[model samples]
Target: MTIFTLSLFSNPLYSQVAVIVHATNQQALTESDIKNLFTGKLKSFPDGNPVIVLNLPEGDPNQSLFNQKVLGRSDAQVKAFWSKLMFTGKGTPPKEVTAEEMIKLVSENPSTIGIVDSAAVSDKVRVLIQH
Candidate 1:
């Protein structure tokens, strides 16, 4: 399974992932900030506004890359982490949506942040970083 997963990511088409937010957000984020947001470490933007993290549904290739590259965890590990957080009432995981839906959500909501395949980024959303 690990070999197959590695091979899927080895494809050049999936080589880059972009972190994005509403164009109006205007907040610069480092990779660490992004990791914090997704892991429930940093709950709000630096300016104090609340944030909503978005993720592609489990098992999506882009989602796998985002989890591994950004969050440093596998899909099941992320799920278990969030489950524990939710069980203890410490935090909730990012809401899951399809890629198309993620674009729409991030474009419509200033506080919504997500990652997507670099090729899918559009004018509606601003790229914070590419990895």
Candidate 2:
């Protein structure tokens, strides 16, 4: 795999790293799905129940990288994106936690998925898809 840098209109300091989620729960998540999930447009997996996506807390390095590179937004932009969606009753932003907490949450909650630096991956969770 290769890492590529992304320079968005707003944030441009994203690191090149694979953002991974739980493998078994989501076979393959399109870029749109990921964007929707982050933006709160889509809730739940292909299944009927609500899907809980975990994210590292604000200012976290991995979170910054994942948002800019994978989600294509800076923290402020992401907040604004969700503000619009949530106000419209279209979607809810993923729950945010610390990196370690997010990892543990994803590892225990079958329906929970999170993004993290590839180097931080462990056997605690199954890597579903990467981008």
Candidate 3:
């Protein structure tokens, strides 16, 4: 039983993460959409609604995972990318918030979207995609 318990704890399948948006948002997003939004490539939903993107504060585990899985970039790389964009007046990075704050903010704004650990997801937001 101890060995079985250890195996369960070590399983990679447990590390599920989700991309979320306000429950009222009806736009369906693919992996590319999520990547583009987070990377400052796509500024609006496919339906033409303006988007508000949120990120977990730097060094947070969920932020790391989302950056790796969705953006295919590291935290430092993301920062550098945003810095260049900001310096050039080309684009702005997403707003950073705590995981708890993200839940509340995304829930309140119909145009907002964010990524969070699957365990933090609740009924207030809709799961747009899982990674």
Candidate 4:
């Protein structure tokens, strides 16, 4: 399959996504862990390693799918959620990156977690969740 790195400008294609971590990452993530990671609730892995989270732009298909299926939030809701957290100084949001950058970032950072189209799963990263 092709490595899925479609630009964020593209329309939502309803494709599945894989939540990935660095290949050396050995965490067995629960659904709660996935949600907490994306939602800014869980800031670090259980071992106290900082969990650096990444995201595709809001309109990206994989971003939408992951937010809906995993985080149970729409783009608007997610935006507002982060906004409130930022304003309240409660939490910081994931950095928005292009799909290609996401793969590159996760590949390079053992502490990072990112979402990409399922078809994009590669040797550079390991899938923690697929939907």
| lDDT: worst 10-residue window of model 4 | 1-10
Model 2: CA > 4 A from native: 1-18, 86-91
Better of 1 and 4 by lDDT: 1
Query: In model 4, where do residues sit more than 4 Å from their true spots?
Result: 1-14
Error of 3 at 52 (Å): 0.3
Off by over 4 Å in 1: 1-13
How far in Å is the alpha carbon of 25 misplaced in model 1? Answer: 1.3
Please give each candidate's TM-score: 0.87, 0.72, 0.89, 0.87
| Candidate 3 lDDT over residue span 1-131, tens digit each | 69989989987556877899998888999999889999889999999999999998999877888888888898899999999999999998899999889999999999999988898899999999887
What C-alpha lDDT do the candidate models reach, one value each?
A: 0.90, 0.69, 0.90, 0.89
Index of the highest-TM-score prediction: 3
User: Clashes in each model (backbone N, CA, C under 3 Å)?
Assistant: 0, 3, 0, 0
Model 2 clashing residue pairs (backbone): 22-128, 23-128, 44-51
Clashes of 3: 0
Clashing pairs in 1: none
Q: Tell me the tens digit of each residue's lDDT in model 2 across 1-131.
A: 22332335335343444445554555467777767776666777666667787777778877777777777888898888878878988777778887767767777777777887776787777765454
Pairs in steric clash, model 3: none
Query: Residue 119 of model 1: what lDDT?
Result: 92
Error of 3 at 71 (Å): 0.8
Which lDDT tens digits does candidate 4 get at residues 13-130?
A: 5567999999999998898998998898899998889999999997997898888899898989999999999999998889999998999999999999999998888998999989
